[model samples]
Target: MAQAKTTLRTTAAAKAASKAPTNATADKLVGTLRDTMVSLVRRDGPDLSARQLAVFLTCYLQEEGHTVRGLAAELNVSKPAITRALDRLGELDLARRKVDPLDRRSVLVQRTLKGAAYLREIRSIMGETSTVAKKETETRVVRATRRAA
Candidate 1:
């Protein structure tokens, strides 16, 4: 009975130890996203709305073949909403709409150089923010361990 209890405790400890890194990673990701957004607003000043940001990210992060209809379906928004977002993106020159050669009715979303540059900047900001967050977390852990000891 004692052996069984020890084994169960060990298993629980292992699971908890495994989950600690995953939780830390998720926290860092959230922090990085927040920091990147603040940096983008402060530096670029496009002041993108939530829907606009969502649309922009979907276009840049996902594979090609993005169309108005496809984006609407993917985002669970109306076609007009997608169109409006596209219009805003167009105004910023971040994205352009091109009529599909195969289907004239379908409008394809294309990335621009400006948009690519913006994405690259965001990636850099995210990486830097994540690294900072990780260091802070490690420092906090070290402090806590010292306190415990």
Candidate 2:
């Protein structure tokens, strides 16, 4: 019962946050996020959970090499959680894990060719979002100007 109440409180907080007014930049960023998500879902690509995508992007974007321990620490998640996400990524052929040559005990997370292509796709989708946001902003400006004239 306590757990259920905590869950309800969390849900209420989320709803309140959504209703909170944000600055134009924050609103625009959220718009971009929404559009990007819609594009990804419309495509036939593998649907990833938020956690999986976070792990994927962190591994790909970071200059430093990634290990299960490193990833967990970087993401503030548990090792098992990282492993689970990696398992899904491996299943999708988007990423792979290899035994580190320097330390056999440690495993390294490496990027796959498919993962690179997927990152490219994400970039393209974000670019499209930027263009759409620009158009929307311009339209708003035009409407405001017409009202003033």
Candidate 3:
């Protein structure tokens, strides 16, 4: 009976210790993603705030045929926020506005060549960062599993 109790305690303690690293890994993942995103944005030749990047990316997605409502849902932002972003994008000439034929009251954002080129550049930069991050994450998981074992 004493042995069984010790075994249970040991298992529970191990589980608790293991959870710490898992949480750390989750935090690291978010940080890595943010860093990589920031780097990619810098490659656009101008430093952009995190909010700006999010707004620009949302607009870019919209230019690719996503509806404003869909973008708002995906970004978890309001329609007005999306509209403001779209206006900024237009001011920069990174996107174009087109009247939605089916909905005369609505406009569809379209990506201009500049926007397309910037996206392509960002993708090229992300390729390396993504590969490195994936490998590092995999390595951390393996190490955690070893400790758990």
Candidate 4:
């Protein structure tokens, strides 16, 4: 007696593979996101580079009483990375480091008056830009969607 032919097919497997993101596409997306964040920060304050602004924001947040460890975790960066950023801000005289009086082992970062002024200016610019961007995006999305007759 002859046995029926056995066959294996992978059409679904091929389609699934096709749907996956390519490394190049992922890299391009990362680059675009970096550029956009930089643009937004620049729109907020043309004076600070993206890196500088990132450091400044971290210091400002800490000055508002956030801990360095907390900021590092929230930012998804290592403690050293956060510390380096803070160092840059300190070097610029925008932030200062102080030893926690309650815990001698802990060092706290605080924003200086200059830092506060810079942050205020950035907030004003960012607020205006954010308003415009929100309106523009809303209009575009509405225009793109179909409306009932």
Maximum-TM-score candidate: 2
Which residue pairs in candidate 3 collide?
none
TM-score of 2: 0.83
| Candidate 1 global lDDT | 0.91
Candidate 2 lDDT score relative to the true structure: 0.94
Q: Evaluate all candidate structures by whole-model CA lDDT and list the values in order.
A: 0.91, 0.94, 0.73, 0.66
In angstroms, the error of model 1 at 114 is 0.3
Runs with alpha carbons beyond 4 Å of true place in candidate 2: 1-22
Where does the lowest 10-residue lDDT sum fall in candidate 2? 16-25
Number of the candidate with higher TM-score, 2 or 4: 2
* lDDT for model 4: 0.66
TM-score for each prediction?
0.82, 0.83, 0.62, 0.51
Better of 2 and 3 by lDDT: 2
Error of 1 at 107 (Å): 0.7
Clashing pairs in 1: none
Summarize candidate 1's per-residue lDDT along 26-101 as a digit string, tens digits: 8778888899889888884577888998999999999877999999999999999999999999999999999999
How big is the positional error of residue 48 in model 3, measured in Å on the Cα after superposition? 3.7
